[model samples]
Target: MAGTNLQTPILQVDHLSMKFGGLVAIGDLSFTAPRGEITALIGPNGAGKTTVFNCITGFYKPTEGMITMTRASGEKFLLERMPDFQITAKAKVARTFQNIRLFSGMTVLENLLVAQHNALMRASGFTVLGLLGLGGYKDASRASIEKAVYWLEKADLMDRADDPAGDLSYGAQRRLEIARAMCTGPELLCLDEPAAGLNPKESLALNELLLGIRRDSGTSILLIEHDMAVVMEISDHVVVLEYGRKISDGSPASVRSDPKVIAAYLGVDDEEVGDVLVEVGDTSVIEELDGVAPVAQGPAETSSMFEGPIADTVEEAGGETIVPASPAASKAAQVEAETAAKSPVEPKGPAQ
Candidate 1:
């Protein structure tokens, strides 16, 4: 908030599209992230969620549309036009992958120090004179070390500064990845599944670390996570994506209650109304939304939209098996799932 005026959004993604041969990874997606907030992008497997992140971070140039980031200093960057390094170097965007990519052979401190290599080189005057330690190279190097130590302290990795990165635990490795990104001094941090393989305790630690980053460092985070617990706990807002399109965007509470979201999860047609009523009970309100007529009938009157082939699909995928429903009930769930997938737009007010 200190750097951003209320007038412009921090990042604006407009009609973004991407393709992989015959597959459409992302389709005409658009959204905005404000100056200071943690936004979570969530979806089931193969949702094109990662593809969108890649496009924004310059890993994949979009087939169409624009990704614009307005910096705190009121500078505007067309992220799609820039190369990957420029996305980090000039646009001040940093990222972490789903898989932790650390310099396994390097010391923990050395890994972080490397993140600030460009800054330190500039400080040393980038010449043979500086390399010979004549133009404050020693002082600059010392300062770089101190900054790396500072981030390590922040990440609670100071104790392992002298250790090889490969020697740390899985959780520590994830934390170090984040610390390394912070070393670059980014304004926007894009994390891809930071909690993918962590145990319960490790996942909770990640939650705390992410919260700390937001509270103390003022860095806005855009994360793609499948861990619902992590998403529900820390995200200020949640966006849901399915296939290649955004379906829902709102607070956690609003998204959880959306009928479209339920249907998406269950993978059923909306016309199968009465099937869900038995599970959810008297879902007449939901039925009305899907334009289905209310049914007054016996138990066997329900249709089996979720039976047979549907059940087999769910079972094979190791997902929950939803009972069959009337046309209204099925529609409600689909509607809810889609609504739940929509990501929250930035609040049109001052940053907290």
Candidate 2:
């Protein structure tokens, strides 16, 4: 809810594409996460949301495009060129997985401490100084413990500090994972479905924790979440993906109201599309049914990313002047006839 610097982007993804063999997982997708803001990437399943995350976090090399991370000190790193480990270690980018990735055998406190391994290793001179308890190792060890304890309290896991991470409940494990990532002192935090299985209360707490991180530490966050409640509440910007392409990008309110987004998510049966367009305030589509060409409004006027009957509906409404299908029943009958012809041998009955 607080203001963030929209002009200064902490991460820039430009024309990014990823391919698995012949399958294009992400295609020419571009978006930005501004410094100290919560940006959410959301879509229906198989929309390539996770693929974009993988490319950003170095889990997958993009087939095309640039991934740039700019730190507060003005240091810039080309993330797509970095190894996964180096992305976290040198570039100060940290992420949590869709599945929990905690060290199950380790204590909750130890899990947090392990996230600080690079710093501790530097302080200990690898292991010799640490084993000898000499030089700055003692001070560094104390500092690591202090940091671990700090995050544990923030995550509300201090009561279970000595318990094995595996022993915590599902929600607790989720919080612990975030706490572990926070211990790494990340400049950019990428979270994959942090609220996937959380109850209402846990989800509320998670929202508070994320907001606190942004407010107190100014850490930039990019999250992939299906929980619209969380996304709508915390996100300053929202980018939508559908079938490996970005379909919408704007503030939560704007994206939520975009007719293209509505069609993509709810899906338009050809029979219902004319009404749906009108319902979403795209009344100009009805002009097509009345024989008047509607004036172009924007890029969405003649372009669409949907498939099947929905695609036909959007294109017809926006693209060309054609014979009027004025009555809803006439449009439905036309679609049913086309569908029947495509599959001739199917059992024919009243349509569901």
Candidate 3:
């Protein structure tokens, strides 16, 4: 992966916080996504990751914190102070939702052309010049169509250009939404769960498409996703959040190895997970168990998010911690005990 100059981040969230009367969706979280990199924000359900996205995109005003965005040309703007339209127009940031928000009744080409509405409207003097086909509206219209066609080809949807967006396959719709966003010519693209319902083939295609966008267009991507495969495979940097706060931020490998992160995924407190030395054999010797040996977490390993297993509190016999005879039994007993201890876990509050 290519690296960017570290002097300034393309988007910087500083001590950001959000409150909805009494619920704190985000609490004093901060992270910097460098320009030209795919920075993935991931966490368990209800981690307030999307709330952070909303704050950055000007959908919600932060109770406290500063969002500083630096344009490609070196102009810096306080994003929190800007309106949503300014964030899109001046800041050059684009976003796609988890739910496909395409114009279902419109043709695929029309949906993308609509993304360029602002530029066309300007060229048309807000319809007066466009209706008369006067001024530069004709030229602008041509350029807009050209841009839409360009993105359609890139997304492999040119053949569907005249097709209604709602009639396309689910995966095609996902690609179309992304292509529609790209027509706006954004510097920073924020995607929320682009791979949500994609099949393996569709997910792979998305990976290639995003990589092409970064390599060819130099657009920075900040994404919120639960798909670990997508997050770990495509992101240049990964930020992990827990309970509305950042628990780890680094390269995928570094964050994966961090014991705190291991604990987070394993549903154990960092303090309870001891470093373990594993020796697998017919009579394997496992030491440093402490009845809470931390499992070495790999990229995107936890499917259950907030729920995971803990080791059984076995006796340390002859200076060697004993694991249960049957691995399955151990997991069953451990999970049951852990659930009993942490039962009635409070639901993570609603996202704003």
Among all candidates shown, the one with the greatest lDDT: 2
Evaluated against the true structure, the overall lDDT of model 1 is 0.76
Model 3 per-residue lDDT tens digits across residues 1-352: 3333556789999999886653456778899998899999988787788899999999999999999988877888899999999999899999998888989999999999899999899999999999999999999999999999888888889999999999998989999999988988988999999999999999998898899999999899999988878887999999988657787899988876765556545344433433221111211111111122223432121322121222235433354544343222223334334445445677898898
Please write out the lDDT profile of model 2 over residues 322-352, one tens digit for every residue.
3333222223333433444445495799978
lDDT of 2 at 60: 92
Worst window of 10 by summed lDDT in candidate 1: 305-314
- Alpha carbon lDDT of each predicted model: 0.76, 0.79, 0.77
Q: Alpha carbon lDDT of residue 17, candidate 3?
A: 85
Over 4 Å off in model 3, which ranges? Answer: 1-7, 266-352
Which regions in candidate 1 have their CA more than 4 angstroms from the true location?
A: 1-3, 265-352
Task: Give per-residue CA lDDT, model 1, range 304-347, as digits (tens).
Answer: 22111111111212446433333343344444443344436666
The predicted structure with the larger lDDT, 2 or 3, is 2
Error of 3 at 143 (Å): 0.7
